[model samples]
Target: MNFDKTELSDEELSRYSRQILLSDINYDGQLKLAQSHAVIFGLGGLGSPVSLYLAAAGVGKLTLVDFDSVDDSNLQRQIVHREANIGQAKVDSAKQNLQALNRHIQIATLNHSLDEAELLTLMESADIAIDCTDNFSSRFAINQACLQAKKPLVSGAAIRWEGQLTTYDFRQDNSPCYACLYKPGSHQELTCSQNGVLSPIVGMVGSMQSLEAVKALLGLPTLMGKLMILDGYTLQIRTLNLKKDTHCPVCQAQS
Candidate 1:
């Protein structure tokens, strides 16, 4: 039901044939994915699914950033790492898994946190950045990099059975950047270690993040102007329209 043999090789046509079946994501759309680069921040619960899906979908290049090493605890939800990778750097572990999924694409790893200048440099070559980090500091940093670079950022967060998804298309004149929604250092940080999270909650949110990233890469319209929240306990989801904060310290200057 997907693309026929014209634009792609028999092997490639067979690999992503299923997705190419969609009217909106036919042969041309697959080509877009084949030519794009994505940089992802963090490689934990959320990053696990996001990276895996993007690789499977044939995103041409991926740069994974994470300084943490895997532990026995992460095995429960961080599905990309194996028991053998328990002490390996997260980016290293993730690179192995993603490369194993699709040897045709490129996977690069950075086993360290990026400072502002470093992030901006990485974002410059990236078509989009995915924020799969856990805390506000990393989130705010990634947001700043994407906004400054005029690239799209697909962000997902999950803690204690609740999750949220949103994208900031810095290309848009009035799109609400992440800084408009949450101020840095204003809220106490939350961690899964201190406050437990249901495994599936992160999987759901992270998968949504991957979808948003793909849509942005393809120049397709998505939940660019709304925030989606999921209540894992109740199994209900809500999407709320977001308004740009004219007074937001970070976004205000951009406006």
Candidate 2:
């Protein structure tokens, strides 16, 4: 793992000048990001910003998973797709957008649903996993896979101006899993399709998710054991401290 200085061409230096100006993520951090890989589930609202930022930030590889195609309804929040990509697969559209943003990175598109086996394969090479999916099934599946693989997971959700974020790192014995906060089959949850979401709300949360992902990949301290809730209507931010549940189905069996 010799992370020597990556020789940035003149064009790359000019392209990433803004990031290079930052003390926290100078040439070294940029090189680290360029060597990292991230898996993003869902190419919807949250996925849009998450993918965009990660690509622009110089992540080496990005694996995008989505089974849906773009439709007129998704334009309200899924910014990655446009009228030209209306009928194209979401993964395809996202890959195009990400490449256009930064062609230096590698973008892998998974135009299908993720099952346990598929997830395990993705996790094998992923440095971090991000849950941008709107459904509980996908989110829970990602959480379980992250736990099993001992990887860090950044989970985010938004619906009608309400957004929430949480990080689960199973490397720690007492860190909570996604199931600790939202139990499986506990209750029916509404998706963006059922309850509309504001376009920028998802952008805000998704960008935050990207930030957390970079932090996790860089081995920096992150919001790993906390739940951040944002109320767009009220413009208020709340942080809830979280703990691993001893009886949580996901964490319990592992412990």
RMSD (Cα, Å) for all candidates, in order, is: 3.3, 1.9
Query: Scored by CA lDDT, what does every candidate get?
Result: 0.89, 0.87
Model 2, 1-255: lDDT tens digits are 124436666776788889888888888777788778899998999999999999988888899989999999999888888889999999999998889889888898898777898798779768889999887888888988888888899999898989999888776777899999998889688987887888999999999999999888877778888999999999999999998888887887776
Number of backbone collisions per candidate: 0, 0
Worst 10 residues of 1 by lDDT: 1-10
Which parts of model 2 have CA positions greater than 4 angstroms off? 1-7
What candidate 1 gets wrong by more than 4 Å, as runs, is 1-7
- Worst 10-residue lDDT window for candidate 2 reads 1-10
135-170 in candidate 1: lDDT tens per residue? 888888899888988999998999998999999999
Residue 138, model 2: lDDT of: 81
TM, every model: 0.95, 0.94
